[model samples]
Target chain A: MREMIKMVVVLTVLSSFSGGLLAAIRNNTKERIEYQQLKFVKGPAIRSILEGCSNDPIVDRFKIKDGDVEHSFFVGVFDGKPSTVALESFGKGFGGNIGVMVGVNVKEDTIVGVGVTTHSETPGVGSRAKTEPDFTAQFQGLPLKKEFKVKADGGQVDALSGATVTSRGVSAALTDAAGIYERVKPQLMEKLKTFAN
Target chain B: MAKTLTQEFVKGLWDEIPPFRLVLGLCPTLAVTKTVENGIGMGLATTFVLVFSNILVSALRKIIPSKVRIACFIIVIATFVTVVELLMQAFTYPLFLKLGIFIPLIVVNCIVLGRAEAFASKNSVLASTADGLGIGVGFTLALGALGGVREILGNGTFLGKTVFGPAFQPFTFMVEAPGAFVCLGLMLCLMNLVGKK
Candidate 1:
């Protein structure tokens, strides 16, 4: 009985100590980890989409609350005008959710660029959605208000040859991006105004 | 028989090296040793966990009851692993992405639990620390060497730099899964041959 009590007490104390330590470390690292994730995972897509823009999109960012979800928008400055905003959205892909970053020209409502940020698509096949510039290049200059779909679905976009599912995934993500852009445009414009210098 | 502090420390470098001599913790040794940078990063992360967990286990050796000692060790080790994971994510996000899942898997690493159960539990705090550091360094060196061999042969690069001229074709097989097994086998064989003296 004494051994059992001791064991229980020891395990309880150890677990509590561990929990407290982890909580403290997590609290300290939360913001930094979030920033690091942005810089590495999403930074490349944002940079590519906002190519030739004067400012760093990763640093100059803002968030807007749309219903229950909070969406982050990265602002891009061209010729000193903060006219482009990059937003991320997800779509079910060949393997899992594909994260797509869509850069839009606020005044024109046209896409400046579209890049894949994350996906679990198969290499050399579905993964080409992220790798081949030709595929993503097709989305450039297209209006953001329309629904995007691959050629197979009777849409304007041409799908990659052997990666129809991945191409469809990217198209779906862009369509989702279009909805998110329309929903958050007012708040996004308001946030971008602050970056205009 | 009692080992002196120097012996305890030095033995881990060669006589009881985790992957090569002790023949333990082969999971990360094979999985993340595709690049020198990744190998070093993983080794350092494991080292941090091993050292801290050893210290904590040694400190709490008396308080932890034998019946629940394994549970206590796990909690302690897991806390440190979480700490390492958080730190890696916060600072080394790229490496964190590369070493994804494997970092969390450190909790189950035999070298860590084996030390906690065999050495740290019986030794003084200072001695356990030395053992951890020694073993950690040994693991790091072994991994670095393995990664160097694979990266140079497989990718024709060393630490991302081209080791051979542009004309040279890389032996891509060295970086794949079957290649890992073959490389590890050859390395183990070489270690045995050298140690035979």
Candidate 2:
């Protein structure tokens, strides 16, 4: 009994110490880490998607409550109007979740652009989703109401050669983004007012 | 004591070098060595976890019960790994994204746990730190060399820059999975030959 109690006590102390140390480090670096992620991980895709916008999408960002989760939306001003908004959505992919950033012109109900932010698809084949401009370019100026599906599934989007799964994954991600944009349109529009002035 | 510390440090470079002499921690070795940048990034992260875990384990060696030592070591090692993960995600977001899953996977890296058990548990703090430093540097060098070779042949590039002329045809196989195995096997064979001599 003594030995067992001693073992339990030792383990508890060790775990507590480790947990405390980790908590301190995490708290110290939270904001910087978040900024870094914005600058690097999601920055390029956001920039490419909202390319023509005069405002910096990363800096001109706001968050909205979405069913207990707060999701960020980047506002982009184009032609002197804060008319476009971009946000991320994820879909199941070959290896894992594929993250796609979709920019929407809420006023026109058309997409500004689409770019892949993160994916674990197979390199060279499935990875073409990120590298192939033609794939992502097709999403630009697309009607948000249009159902996104690969050509194989009787939709307009073409699948990457030899990477049908990844193509489908990307299409699904865009569909998800469209769904999100539709649901958040009212809230997003209200938030856009804050950036306008 | 000084001689023993030096021995522990020096041994990790050659006598007990990992993924070569010791034949440990092969997962990250295989996964991240496609680019020199990724290899060095992973090695340094592992080194951070390894060194800190070693020092903490050594400090608490006497206090931790024999029955629960493994659990205690894991908790310590996991804390450091999370710290690295958060720091990397904040500062090096692109590399953090590129080395995804592998960073969290470092918690289970046998090398950290193995060192905790074999050296830190039985050695002094200074010696364990030395051991961790030497092993970490050795691992970094090995990954850098492997990544360099694969990148040069597979893409005709060094760290994404074209090293070979535009006319140069890359050996695509070297960047693929089979290529990773073949390259590692050949390198291991060469190491064995040198050891024999």
User: For residues A1-197, what per-residue lDDT tens digits would candidate 2 score against the true structure?
Assistant: 99899999998888888789888988999888877878787999999888888988888888987787778888889888998888888878898999888888889989888888999999998999999989888888889874689999999888889999888998998887777777878888888888875
Could you report the DockQ of all the candidates, in the order they appear? 0.91, 0.67
How well does candidate 2 score on lDDT at residue B171? 97
Which ranges in model 2 have alpha carbons more than 4 Å from their true place?
A: A31-42, A66-70, A79-81, A88-102, A106-111, A114-190, B1-4, B195-197
lDDT of 1 by residue, B24-121 (tens): 99999999999999999999999999999999999989888888889899999999999999999999899999999999999999999999999999
How far in Å is the alpha carbon of A182 misplaced in model 1?
Answer: 1.7
Clashes of 2: 1
Worst 10 residues of 1 chain A by lDDT: A183-192
Expressed as tens digits, the lDDT of each residue in A97-119 for candidate 1 is 99999999999999999999999
